[model samples]
Target: MRGKSSIEVSAKLKHSFLFPDEYLDWANETENNFYVESPLIYEVAFYNGIKALKPWETIEYIPVVLTEWKKVKLEIESKFEKRDAKGATLPMRVGIGLFLELLFWTNGQPVELNPIIPLESLKIKPVNITERFAFILARPNLFHSYKQLAELMVEMEKLYVKSIIVRK
Candidate 1:
């Protein structure tokens, strides 16, 4: 209960080495001090970088395909009710947050979809690519300390900067 928490003090010390001088100046000038100063920047950036690796970037559009689970469950309830009344073992076709993590921030702009695309016209297929998914929320990981987090920030800051600078 003094000036700064251990994590905060550690981050301030680490940022000097992690962020480039030019980026620091740019961050200062742009009124986005939190970008450079936040202790959680590394975890935030690492997660965002993970999101930036979507396979659909070449298509120049990312789709937020959502399946409402309860609705799906109800729709399919009759078929499975006799066999499995609980519906405890519902498969991926049922809505779960796993599919959401499969989505990433694509470089391509989000396409404004036409309201009239027939359901049959769309291809219904599983994602073919195999990739690691981090299902956890943004919180302190037991393995990565503030120092390790800062190191990750050093690696990802350039990408983060490039992405935000255009918006600025």
Candidate 2:
């Protein structure tokens, strides 16, 4: 069914992504049940048990607080650090670099990714519509959830920057 097609699409298009295959698979699996019209578009069906229902309101939820989100981010980063000797960090750095490049290319802004510097030393770069469009075009299956995760991380970084400014 829908899940099978989605998995096939994800696997076929995996080359464009900088993320690990397993991580990308985890991100793509959640979206399997939804209908995909094309690589860039998908339809989500909602049911009321009795019958299918038209979508009404989609509730926006930010269940994780800033602290909790940061903790999760740190845990991921720690795992990367531990596996750095095994080449874990390269994919992460490449993923982050690709995201930053997309941001820069879309916004016509300059960005630099120095491997020698700590990730914290890098500036926060917010994603925009044009860049998102490019991402969807490249990997539509990953667009929804992955973009949300990236945006949340960007927002968290912005909040951290603001906190430092306020503290000073």
Candidate 3:
């Protein structure tokens, strides 16, 4: 029964157009591709994450007001744990990676506000699927087909770029 369900999902995925044909072709080419399951569950998970962001309409930034650094860090960590529990896929890890980058990136930038200023905040921008795949490509050793994936993402980006809006 489990095998039947897996097969059914695979059939549906091939026709779903959730990802570009080039990407689907590359992912399906190898049986032992790193973290690239035949059913492409991880890719689907990543797509689902991006869809949650409503990218077709607008790319939303998660606004977080700063009170104390530690408190914000803890809250983010808790959210990460919850997301991980659902499925610790590439997208989830990319989110945590972006968070870490934000921490470091913000530290060097100068702020003109007074030290006691209230509600000073930072926005966490959403990374599109192509960007997320590029992030994964940075660690090429993890996936043998990383270069192909990167190329495919570029194509996918070109096709869908017009529909995506960057919200101010």
Candidate 4:
């Protein structure tokens, strides 16, 4: 996405995403390419099944975009996001979503909220391996962790570059 041209095209983006929520009895369908003001745990419903989801109480957001499948990597732990009063964006730390291959294959189905399910249950496989994961959460501590992780990634990339130059 960062390098691709606007005119360039690839496999069309998957319009529908599966949101998995144990609270939901089943999956439901609407027009493709919809977003909720808040996060709804769902599957790529076009495939997962159909149902209604609990109304979001804390955040108002929509699915941002069906992205190329590479950026969505996750790790497990208490997550956080920084916000200001009224829950708006602020300079913040972010925690990581623990991603596993097992979670990726969950039929993007909903599971009852239980301690056993330690990972996100569903994923939207819009393009490549990385599916679009729209998370509407209300944690602040995780954000700082994410900030640190992001910084680590930057450093890794720089080292990778330096190594390439040395090799040359």
TM-score of each: 0.18, 0.27, 0.19, 0.25
- lDDT per residue for candidate 4 within 123-156, as digits (tens), equals 3322222222222223323444344434433433
Candidate 2 Cα outliers beyond 4 Å, as residue runs: 1-6, 10-15, 18-59, 62-72, 80-168
Which of the numbered candidates is closest to the native, going by highest TM-score? 2
Q: Scored by Cα lDDT, where does model 4 land?
A: 0.27
Each prediction's Cα RMSD?
19.9, 13.3, 17.9, 15.4
Q: Residue 112 deviation, candidate 3, in Å?
A: 46
Candidate 3 per-residue lDDT over residues 7-86, each given as its tens digit = 12232233212223424223332322223112233333234232111111212211221122234334434544564433
Per-residue CA lDDT of model 1 for 80-112, tens digit only, reads: 445443342232122222122212222222111
Which residue pairs clash within candidate 2?
none
What is each predicted model's overall lDDT from 0 to 1?
0.26, 0.34, 0.30, 0.27
Q: Give lDDT for model 3.
A: 0.30
Off by over 4 Å in 3: 1-144, 164-168
Clashing pairs in 1: none
Order candidates by TM-score, high to low: 2, 4, 3, 1
Residue-pair clashes per candidate, as listed? 0, 0, 0, 34
